[model samples]
Target: MASVTENKPSNPWQVWRPGIDPAADALERVSVLINRHEHITAGYAFTLGESARRYAEQCSLGFLLGLEMVVREHGNQAAILGWRHAASTVPQPSKSQNEGEKDA
Candidate 1:
Protein backbone atom coordinates (compact mmCIF):
# COMPACT_ATOMS: atom_id res chain seq x y z
CA MET A 1 0.00 0.00 0.00
CA ALA A 2 1.16 3.53 -0.80
CA SER A 3 0.93 6.32 1.78
CA VAL A 4 0.18 9.95 1.01
CA THR A 5 1.97 12.77 2.79
CA GLU A 6 1.21 16.46 2.95
CA ASN A 7 3.85 18.82 1.70
CA LYS A 8 4.54 22.25 3.17
CA PRO A 9 5.94 25.22 1.34
CA SER A 10 9.55 26.05 1.94
CA ASN A 11 10.13 29.16 4.08
CA PRO A 12 12.95 31.63 3.50
CA TRP A 13 15.69 31.45 6.12
CA GLN A 14 16.71 35.07 5.80
CA VAL A 15 15.24 38.31 4.44
CA TRP A 16 17.26 39.56 1.51
CA ARG A 17 18.06 43.22 0.89
CA PRO A 18 18.32 44.84 -2.55
CA GLY A 19 21.84 44.88 -4.02
CA ILE A 20 23.22 43.02 -1.03
CA ASP A 21 23.77 39.30 -0.38
CA PRO A 22 24.69 39.14 3.28
CA ALA A 23 24.92 35.34 3.56
CA ALA A 24 27.18 35.02 0.55
CA ASP A 25 29.44 37.82 1.70
CA ALA A 26 29.58 36.45 5.22
CA LEU A 27 30.46 32.96 4.03
CA GLU A 28 33.10 34.25 1.65
CA ARG A 29 34.81 36.35 4.31
CA VAL A 30 34.65 33.49 6.80
CA SER A 31 36.20 31.12 4.27
CA VAL A 32 39.04 33.54 3.60
CA LEU A 33 39.74 34.02 7.31
CA ILE A 34 39.67 30.26 7.93
CA ASN A 35 42.09 29.65 5.09
CA ARG A 36 44.47 32.34 6.27
CA HIS A 37 44.39 31.04 9.82
CA GLU A 38 44.91 27.48 8.67
CA HIS A 39 47.98 28.54 6.71
CA ILE A 40 49.39 30.27 9.78
CA THR A 41 48.73 27.20 11.96
CA ALA A 42 50.15 24.73 9.48
CA GLY A 43 52.94 23.66 11.85
CA TYR A 44 50.72 23.21 14.91
CA ALA A 45 50.30 19.66 16.24
CA PHE A 46 47.80 20.09 19.09
CA THR A 47 44.00 19.85 18.99
CA LEU A 48 43.82 23.12 20.98
CA GLY A 49 44.45 25.25 17.88
CA GLU A 50 41.95 23.29 15.82
CA SER A 51 39.34 23.60 18.53
CA ALA A 52 39.86 27.32 18.77
CA ARG A 53 39.47 27.68 15.01
CA ARG A 54 36.21 25.76 15.11
CA TYR A 55 34.90 27.98 17.91
CA ALA A 56 35.85 31.12 16.01
CA GLU A 57 34.04 29.94 12.88
CA GLN A 58 30.87 29.23 14.85
CA CYS A 59 31.06 32.63 16.57
CA SER A 60 31.58 34.42 13.24
CA LEU A 61 28.51 32.73 11.76
CA GLY A 62 26.38 33.76 14.75
CA PHE A 63 27.68 37.32 14.66
CA LEU A 64 26.96 37.71 10.95
CA LEU A 65 23.40 36.41 11.26
CA GLY A 66 22.72 38.61 14.30
CA LEU A 67 24.10 41.67 12.53
CA GLU A 68 21.82 41.14 9.56
CA MET A 69 18.76 40.82 11.83
CA VAL A 70 19.69 43.96 13.78
CA VAL A 71 20.19 45.97 10.59
CA ARG A 72 16.82 44.97 9.16
CA GLU A 73 15.02 45.74 12.41
CA HIS A 74 16.72 49.12 12.81
CA GLY A 75 16.08 50.14 9.20
CA ASN A 76 12.37 49.41 9.57
CA GLN A 77 12.17 51.29 12.87
CA ALA A 78 13.91 54.35 11.45
CA ALA A 79 11.57 54.51 8.46
CA ILE A 80 8.49 54.32 10.66
CA LEU A 81 9.82 56.95 13.04
CA GLY A 82 10.58 59.32 10.18
CA TRP A 83 7.12 58.88 8.73
CA ARG A 84 5.47 59.60 12.09
CA HIS A 85 7.46 62.79 12.55
CA ALA A 86 6.70 63.99 9.03
CA ALA A 87 2.99 63.31 9.40
CA SER A 88 2.80 65.23 12.64
CA THR A 89 4.44 68.37 11.20
CA VAL A 90 2.45 68.43 7.94
CA PRO A 91 -0.14 71.27 7.74
CA GLN A 92 -3.57 70.74 6.21
CA PRO A 93 -3.92 72.16 2.69
CA SER A 94 -7.09 74.08 3.66
CA LYS A 95 -5.38 75.70 6.62
CA SER A 96 -2.51 76.98 4.44
CA GLN A 97 -4.85 78.39 1.79
CA ASN A 98 -7.08 80.15 4.34
CA GLU A 99 -4.05 81.77 6.01
CA GLY A 100 -3.37 83.91 2.89
CA GLU A 101 -7.02 85.02 2.36
CA LYS A 102 -8.25 88.36 3.70
CA ASP A 103 -11.85 89.59 4.18
CA ALA A 104 -12.95 91.86 1.32
Candidate 2:
Protein backbone atom coordinates (compact mmCIF):
# COMPACT_ATOMS: atom_id res chain seq x y z
CA MET A 1 0.00 0.00 0.00
CA ALA A 2 1.27 3.52 -0.86
CA SER A 3 1.00 6.24 1.74
CA VAL A 4 -0.01 9.76 0.78
CA THR A 5 1.05 12.91 2.62
CA GLU A 6 -0.93 16.09 2.61
CA ASN A 7 0.84 19.30 1.62
CA LYS A 8 0.49 22.39 3.70
CA PRO A 9 1.73 25.81 2.61
CA SER A 10 4.38 27.41 4.71
CA ASN A 11 4.15 31.03 5.84
CA PRO A 12 6.23 33.44 3.80
CA TRP A 13 9.31 34.87 5.49
CA GLN A 14 9.04 38.60 6.15
CA VAL A 15 11.92 40.91 5.35
CA TRP A 16 13.16 42.46 8.58
CA ARG A 17 12.34 46.13 9.16
CA PRO A 18 14.49 48.72 10.94
CA GLY A 19 11.95 49.78 13.53
CA ILE A 20 11.10 46.23 14.44
CA ASP A 21 14.54 44.79 15.03
CA PRO A 22 17.71 46.00 16.72
CA ALA A 23 19.84 44.22 14.15
CA ALA A 24 17.84 45.87 11.43
CA ASP A 25 18.32 49.22 13.14
CA ALA A 26 22.06 48.69 13.29
CA LEU A 27 22.10 47.75 9.63
CA GLU A 28 20.12 50.82 8.69
CA ARG A 29 22.23 53.15 10.80
CA VAL A 30 25.47 51.91 9.31
CA SER A 31 23.96 52.03 5.86
CA VAL A 32 22.91 55.65 6.30
CA LEU A 33 26.26 56.72 7.75
CA ILE A 34 28.08 55.03 4.88
CA ASN A 35 25.95 56.82 2.34
CA ARG A 36 26.24 60.20 4.00
CA HIS A 37 30.01 60.09 4.50
CA GLU A 38 30.64 58.67 1.04
CA HIS A 39 28.25 61.16 -0.57
CA ILE A 40 26.78 58.47 -2.79
CA THR A 41 23.11 58.26 -3.61
CA ALA A 42 21.16 55.13 -2.96
CA GLY A 43 22.02 52.21 -5.27
CA TYR A 44 25.19 53.92 -6.43
CA ALA A 45 28.56 52.16 -6.49
CA PHE A 46 31.45 53.32 -4.27
CA THR A 47 34.84 53.55 -6.01
CA LEU A 48 36.93 54.49 -2.98
CA GLY A 49 37.88 52.44 0.10
CA GLU A 50 37.36 48.70 0.42
CA SER A 51 35.19 49.26 3.49
CA ALA A 52 33.15 51.80 1.60
CA ARG A 53 32.67 49.44 -1.31
CA ARG A 54 31.61 46.54 0.91
CA TYR A 55 29.27 48.61 3.05
CA ALA A 56 27.67 50.19 0.00
CA GLU A 57 27.04 46.77 -1.49
CA GLN A 58 25.52 45.52 1.74
CA CYS A 59 23.33 48.58 2.08
CA SER A 60 22.09 48.28 -1.50
CA LEU A 61 21.19 44.62 -1.01
CA GLY A 62 19.13 45.36 2.09
CA PHE A 63 17.54 48.41 0.46
CA LEU A 64 16.57 46.54 -2.69
CA LEU A 65 15.14 43.63 -0.76
CA GLY A 66 13.19 45.97 1.49
CA LEU A 67 11.88 47.93 -1.49
CA GLU A 68 10.79 44.72 -3.19
CA MET A 69 8.89 43.69 -0.08
CA VAL A 70 7.27 47.09 0.23
CA VAL A 71 6.23 47.11 -3.43
CA ARG A 72 4.81 43.63 -3.14
CA GLU A 73 2.93 44.53 0.00
CA HIS A 74 1.64 47.92 -1.04
CA GLY A 75 1.54 47.77 -4.83
CA ASN A 76 2.54 50.87 -6.85
CA GLN A 77 1.22 53.64 -4.63
CA ALA A 78 4.22 54.80 -2.57
CA ALA A 79 3.10 58.09 -1.08
CA ILE A 80 2.27 56.61 2.33
CA LEU A 81 4.38 53.49 2.23
CA GLY A 82 7.23 55.14 4.17
CA TRP A 83 4.92 56.08 7.03
CA ARG A 84 3.31 52.68 7.09
CA HIS A 85 6.63 50.91 7.00
CA ALA A 86 7.95 53.02 9.89
CA ALA A 87 4.97 52.34 12.11
CA SER A 88 6.30 50.93 15.36
CA THR A 89 6.41 47.20 15.83
CA VAL A 90 9.42 46.85 18.11
CA PRO A 91 9.26 47.94 21.72
CA GLN A 92 10.63 51.30 22.80
CA PRO A 93 14.22 51.55 23.94
CA SER A 94 15.14 50.89 27.55
CA LYS A 95 15.98 53.63 30.05
CA SER A 96 19.67 53.55 29.21
CA GLN A 97 19.00 53.86 25.52
CA ASN A 98 16.41 56.52 26.15
CA GLU A 99 19.13 58.44 28.00
CA GLY A 100 21.05 58.73 24.71
CA GLU A 101 23.62 56.13 25.56
CA LYS A 102 23.89 52.56 24.35
CA ASP A 103 25.36 49.81 26.50
CA ALA A 104 28.78 48.64 25.48
Candidate 3:
Protein backbone atom coordinates (compact mmCIF):
# COMPACT_ATOMS: atom_id res chain seq x y z
CA MET A 1 0.00 0.00 0.00
CA ALA A 2 1.25 3.49 -0.85
CA SER A 3 1.27 6.09 1.88
CA VAL A 4 -0.44 9.34 1.18
CA THR A 5 0.06 12.76 2.71
CA GLU A 6 -2.76 15.20 3.23
CA ASN A 7 -2.50 18.64 1.75
CA LYS A 8 -2.82 21.48 4.17
CA PRO A 9 -5.40 24.18 3.64
CA SER A 10 -4.26 27.47 2.09
CA ASN A 11 -4.82 30.75 3.92
CA PRO A 12 -8.37 32.10 3.82
CA TRP A 13 -7.20 35.25 2.07
CA GLN A 14 -5.56 33.10 -0.59
CA VAL A 15 -8.56 30.77 -0.88
CA TRP A 16 -10.99 33.68 -1.00
CA ARG A 17 -9.80 34.47 -4.51
CA PRO A 18 -10.72 32.12 -7.36
CA GLY A 19 -9.63 31.30 -10.93
CA ILE A 20 -6.20 30.64 -12.43
CA ASP A 21 -5.15 32.95 -15.25
CA PRO A 22 -6.38 36.03 -13.47
CA ALA A 23 -4.51 34.94 -10.36
CA ALA A 24 -1.37 34.67 -12.44
CA ASP A 25 -1.87 38.18 -13.71
CA ALA A 26 -2.31 39.45 -10.17
CA LEU A 27 0.89 37.78 -9.11
CA GLU A 28 2.76 39.37 -11.98
CA ARG A 29 1.51 42.80 -11.04
CA VAL A 30 2.53 42.19 -7.45
CA SER A 31 6.00 41.14 -8.54
CA VAL A 32 6.38 44.36 -10.47
CA LEU A 33 5.34 46.36 -7.43
CA ILE A 34 7.78 44.53 -5.19
CA ASN A 35 10.61 45.05 -7.61
CA ARG A 36 9.81 48.73 -7.85
CA HIS A 37 9.59 49.22 -4.11
CA GLU A 38 12.39 46.95 -3.00
CA HIS A 39 14.10 49.84 -1.25
CA ILE A 40 11.19 50.57 1.05
CA THR A 41 10.97 49.15 4.56
CA ALA A 42 11.46 45.42 4.19
CA GLY A 43 8.28 44.77 6.16
CA TYR A 44 4.52 45.19 6.16
CA ALA A 45 4.19 47.84 3.47
CA PHE A 46 5.91 45.67 0.92
CA THR A 47 4.12 42.58 2.10
CA LEU A 48 0.60 44.01 1.98
CA GLY A 49 1.24 45.58 -1.41
CA GLU A 50 2.23 42.22 -2.82
CA SER A 51 -0.70 40.43 -1.27
CA ALA A 52 -3.23 42.98 -2.49
CA ARG A 53 -1.69 42.89 -5.94
CA ARG A 54 -1.96 39.10 -6.00
CA TYR A 55 -5.54 39.14 -4.83
CA ALA A 56 -6.41 41.79 -7.35
CA GLU A 57 -4.73 39.89 -10.17
CA GLN A 58 -5.88 36.39 -9.26
CA CYS A 59 -9.46 37.39 -8.56
CA SER A 60 -11.75 39.80 -10.31
CA LEU A 61 -11.26 43.46 -9.47
CA GLY A 62 -14.82 43.52 -8.22
CA PHE A 63 -14.09 40.66 -5.87
CA LEU A 64 -10.93 42.30 -4.58
CA LEU A 65 -12.59 45.67 -4.23
CA GLY A 66 -15.61 44.09 -2.56
CA LEU A 67 -13.33 42.33 -0.13
CA GLU A 68 -11.75 45.66 0.71
CA MET A 69 -15.17 47.19 1.31
CA VAL A 70 -16.18 44.25 3.45
CA VAL A 71 -12.98 44.61 5.38
CA ARG A 72 -13.54 48.32 5.80
CA GLU A 73 -17.17 47.89 6.86
CA HIS A 74 -16.66 44.77 8.93
CA GLY A 75 -13.39 45.85 10.51
CA ASN A 76 -9.80 44.73 9.92
CA GLN A 77 -9.69 41.11 11.02
CA ALA A 78 -9.77 39.53 7.58
CA ALA A 79 -7.47 42.15 6.14
CA ILE A 80 -5.07 41.72 9.00
CA LEU A 81 -4.79 38.01 8.30
CA GLY A 82 -3.80 38.70 4.74
CA TRP A 83 -1.41 41.44 5.81
CA ARG A 84 0.23 39.23 8.39
CA HIS A 85 1.03 36.55 5.85
CA ALA A 86 2.52 39.03 3.43
CA ALA A 87 4.62 40.96 5.94
CA SER A 88 7.14 38.19 6.54
CA THR A 89 7.72 34.82 8.14
CA VAL A 90 8.55 36.72 11.33
CA PRO A 91 5.78 38.76 12.92
CA GLN A 92 5.93 42.53 12.48
CA PRO A 93 4.81 44.99 15.13
CA SER A 94 1.04 45.25 15.34
CA LYS A 95 1.12 48.87 16.46
CA SER A 96 2.46 51.75 14.46
CA GLN A 97 5.48 53.43 15.93
CA ASN A 98 4.75 56.82 17.39
CA GLU A 99 7.13 59.68 17.89
CA GLY A 100 6.50 59.46 21.60
CA GLU A 101 7.28 55.78 21.75
CA LYS A 102 10.56 55.11 23.48
CA ASP A 103 12.82 52.37 22.31
CA ALA A 104 13.14 49.39 24.62
The TM-score obtained by model 1 is: 0.20
The whole-model C-alpha lDDT of candidate 1 against the native structure comes to 0.38
Model 1 per-residue lDDT at 69: 48
What is candidate 2's local distance difference test score? Answer: 0.38
Q: Candidate 3: how large is its RMSD?
A: 16.8
* CA lDDT, every model vs. true structure: 0.38, 0.38, 0.48
lDDT of 1 at 34: 40
Candidate 2 lDDT over residue span 1-104, tens digit each: 54343254443234454345443443444444344544543332122222222323334566645643543343322312322343333245789786776435
Tens-digit lDDT track for model 3 on 46-73? 4545466455534676766754454334
lDDT, candidate 1, residue 100?
Answer: 62
Residues 50-101, model 1: lDDT tens digits: 2222333334667635533433343233322332343345455686577767
Q: For every model shown, what is its TM-score relative to the native structure?
A: 0.20, 0.21, 0.27
Evaluated at residue 34, the lDDT of candidate 3 is 43
User: If the candidates were sorted by their TM-score against the true structure, best first, what order would they fall in?
Assistant: 3, 2, 1
Clashes per prediction? 0, 0, 2
